[model samples]
Target: MEVRAQLASVFHLDKCLGCHTCSVVCKNLWTDRKGSEHMWWNNVETRPGTGYPPLWEDQQRHHGGWVLAGGELRLRLGSRPHVLDQLFQPPTLPTLDDQYEPWTYRYGDLLGADPTKDLPTARPVSAITGRPIDPSAGPNWDDDLGGSAVHAAADPNLAALDPDERQALLAFDRLVFFHLPRTCNHCLNPACAAACPSGAIYKRGEDGIVVLAKERCRGWRMCVPACPYKKTFHSWLEGKSEKCIGCYPRLESGDAPACFHACTGRIRYQGVLLYDADAAARAARAPDERLVDAFRDALLDPADPDVAAEAARAGLGEAVLAAARRSPVDRFVRDWELALPLHPEFRTLPMVFYVPPLSPVRAVRSDGARPVSDDLLADPAALRIPIRYLASLFAAGNERVVVDALQALAAVRAHRRARTAGDVTAADAARLLLEAGLDEATADAIHRLTVFPTLRERVVHPPLAREGEADRDPGIQGLVGLRRRVTS
Candidate 1:
């Protein structure tokens, strides 16, 4: 049991309001610079639509993540020798069009144009070239199911569904969609770190936050394709690669990441997770269908004595262990089993998990009139968003696990509604909870954490002990801390 402490997160998709506050705040803080315009370190994409880089989930084209071969995991891009050979020009690298040409409108045209001219207006122009251009795409081009026929129809996850199911889902009357906020998973087995030829990307030993050192980066841009999530990007002007740092500078000072702080929906939860390193390795190598279970098995109980002893041996401080014990992420993912990893088949061992959204109940039309199903609130099996679709996204095509999670979430809702609304009877709620393999106390606990987590409860991390390290160098210390504050 090679226990190690890692920072992890859970996003409750049901609560996400799709307000884009998290994305805007993250942009202003991190990627708002020349050559970084195309980089959205945090982006919210709509489901049933191609993501930012347009078809990024189509690993067949991007050649990202990892692949299992002969019971061993290897980079989908290729082996080290193959990667080195293509160092100069990566054949699978996504073009600027694929990522959308960053654009801006010429506001000066509107200001300076003749007053008599026919309704002076700003003209769209490329942010990169400063030339007139017709804007067609953007980071969230398919937001709210925009151009659904074209963009939403091309969703890669829909490949798992039968043709009949696909057609029914895309039908005019049954269209369904949800917001998917994304960031670097800060994976336990980081493909970006593994594919970096210059060794610029590395996970921090203390907290497991992946950092791409600008000084060490050679600008090979291998990390771009290697990152299955497409979170890594190249800085054309600076000749460096940049990615979400998980706001480490703030974290070391005991604050949450900017996105988490700015989130409008309060859907984000961050905390410490204790996992067995060896178990994580084995889990990553498990067959596709078993990946979710294997991944969950890899996470150790923070309160377990044996796990604590191993974590101590691995140099985890008491503070970190305590945080792990109180982690809301652990409760959602491990204790209640309501949250699951996104695309576990990618084999990145992502630390970020999601509580999949519960869609509207499927209804039927009778004699030109529609009636909601009687089991609208009871049967999650009547999910409007096909279980297979969500399974592809989170459970590596394992419908059973996805069904289990959705059922548990339904039980929580049922239990709460019974208590508050008086519409559902106590016996009915108990029966539903029992069917979902949950007791009343456990259901209430899950409900409380999901619906009413405090700021400290949502984001939990121990002191990083960076002050002593930062004190070693006054120049760096002055930048990272308040050492140079003018306090006469």
Candidate 2:
């Protein structure tokens, strides 16, 4: 049966409060277990700063995401199903020494002692690696992707100047900030689904939600790297790859995802969207403007009768169709034209939409003005929009996308400054943090941890043959050992 298509999304700039309430709610409901402490199915982060686990965006350094090969966007996971399945399996447990090592802070050791005239600052070192642990790195490092404070920290133009001078320069120049909360985009053409060897991952017919059948999963980790967003994760305990299921259980019952339900911003909206199934498949196989642009254009009118009819013919329920008719996303997507896809170039055809942030440019001036009324820096959320973060989502290999996106947001802020014709003082709090040299250090840390090794090694090597002797290969050793152990 043809599956119906539905969509949902969060407005990072408007609704999230970074309170961790959503994360806590989800943790207690789903991931609060022995192996889940490090896992946050729903995590909130401080933008313009490193996110949890740090620098997850430096996909180039980490060796993740898509690559353009022979003019096609090739998912890092091989095109074949078998190859992807083989990679999806869970990993074997490392020895305790490898998994859990003791940790301590060196500076903590000097707290109460009679110290030298100049007391040294605290530094952290890893007990296991015996190397100094840089404090500022992780998966979500650059959470705001260096849009605000991090940007100011990285740019020498802003770094060398004093606070007042920097504020004057910013006011003179005009700047802005925004926030982008992200999750699995659940693309119309999902690389994760295509890469599945067992055909276990499939998009639902009812709502276009993607799902993975645990029993059919062989624990290959191909999907982990295949997805540019890094949304798919391998469950070592379950020995399978898993990802966002679009909260199907709740969706079926007319509710929203755990993250959406718990979102304080109320920026999330859920509804059905109709796209030509044939077109979707074509886009999945061969993405281009003709196909992808058509789908995006349809999002502009998700509630059109023709669209609803098409969705119904695709096996969507009347209730779902009715919901789509009134969905706020439909209005935002079509009428207001405020929503845009997170990353269009990934060729995954993601469905989430974001309302561009508009706060930063209103804060500062380029002409050494006094203060302006339109500065976004006055608002924290406005400070969260970093081009780096968006570029991380869209431009997998290039850093320019992030720079461009940031500049675009900054332009918007600049426009606000021009409109308001006001002078403003830049917040020293964000500026001081930027000057302390923390952002880049943190981004570097996140990039290191998110690395997924793709080195190729033979699991079963051929036996070497001595001169004139028939040789047996070592391929059967594992089987033989298993048999012997079982029989004995």
Candidate 3:
């Protein structure tokens, strides 16, 4: 059990209100530079839509991640020969057309305009070019427009649904979308790191945060198409590949990433996760349906005496172990089984997990009115959003797991509502909660973590010994601190 620590994240989709505060703050802080107009390091994509890069989940087009070849794992993108050929001319790479040509308003027209008969209007112009733009698409262009056949119909996840289900999913009233805020997963099995021919990308040993060295980068766009999540992007202006660093600089100083800090919904949770290095390959190689469970199996119990001994032997400091024990991410993902990784079939072993949203049961709620289906509030029927759709996103097409998770979430809500709303009897709540394998205490705990986590509660930074880093040579301290591995 070769224990190691990774910086893991959990986003409670249940609490996300589709507010773009996370995106806005991330843009303002990091990707606001030239050649990054279309790059959204943190983006909130609406479900039932094609997402930011337009059909990013269509691995058939992207040809990213890995595949079984001769009973061995190999990059689905290609081997070295194919990679060299596709370097300068990456046909599979997403162009500005796919991820819309970014535009900004000619704000000078509005802010500094001469008095005229017509209203002072700012025309939308290409952020890249000085010419006027039509503003055809944007980061959240498909937001709340899941009913549009042009947008939602093109969703790749819809492939899992039958023709009839697909049609209904695109229907106006049937369209109930959820927010999927995405960033670089900083995967345990990082395909981007492996695909970078320049070997610029490397995962930190201490925290598992994947980083790309600008100087070593050879300007090859291979990593872009190779990342299944499309998190890696080439900056035309900088001649380098860039991605979310998980705000490592801030993290070393005991601060959360800008997006996590600025999140209005308080849906983001960050913490340490202890896991076995030996399990990553097997977990990634698991059958698609079992990938989520395999990944969870990779994460060893931090509180386990045997696991703790392995951690100590593997050089994990006491502080990290403590953080792992207290990790809400561990509770949500492993203990309570409330959260799941997105697109586990991608096989990148993404560190970030999501607590799937529980859509409101289809019913009217008036004063002294009873719910149409008490089973929905207690037993969790696919009332608003189809369970199959969510299963595609999170469970690698495992509807059974999605059903169980949704049922568990519903049980928590039912337990709470009975006490607060008197909509159901205590017996009803207890029965449902028991059916879902939860008690009131556990339900309350899950509810608190999902809804009202404080900054300290949400972000649990393991003590990175920075005192000695400060005492190092000031000129090279930054380099020294970064290059220092966990084994060092």
Most accurate candidate by TM-score: 1
Measured by lDDT, the strongest candidate is 1
Note the residue pairs that clash in candidate 1.
none
Q: For candidate 1, give the lDDT of residue 159.
A: 93
TM-score of 1: 0.94
lDDT of 1 by residue, 84-139 (tens): 99999889887887788888899998888876848888988888899999978889
Q: Which residue pairs collide, candidate 3?
A: none
Task: Give the winner by TM-score: 2 or 3.
Answer: 3
The deviation in Å at residue 158 for candidate 2 is 14
- What would the C-alpha RMSD of candidate 1 be, to one decimal place? 5.2
User: What lDDT does the true structure give each of the candidates?
Assistant: 0.85, 0.47, 0.80
TM-score of each: 0.94, 0.59, 0.91
lDDT of 2 by residue, 1-488 (tens): 13344565535354445555666776687655544334455555543333433433434433334555675666654446546345535232122222123334776557765767886666677644547765444333444434445533443223334565455433424433334466677776677776666777776543456677788887655565556556666654566666767665665444557777776655556554545555544444443324334444445244566665654454345555555555555544444334556545556777776654433433433354545433333323233233334433333223343343333334333333433544432343234224332233332331221122111110001111221122244232111111111110
Deviation (Å) of 325 in candidate 3: 0.5
TM-score of 3: 0.91
Q: Which lDDT tens digits does candidate 3 get at residues 1-488?
A: 66777879999888788889999998888998889988899999988788888788889989888876665677888887888887778777777786788778888989899888889998988877778989777788889764366888888888887786777666665567788999999988888887888889988754778888888999887889899999888786787889998998788787889888988889999988777877867888888888888888888888899997877666666777788888888898888888899898888889999988887554432233445656666545545667778899999998877877888888888888888988877898899888889988999998888767899999987765433453453332121222344321
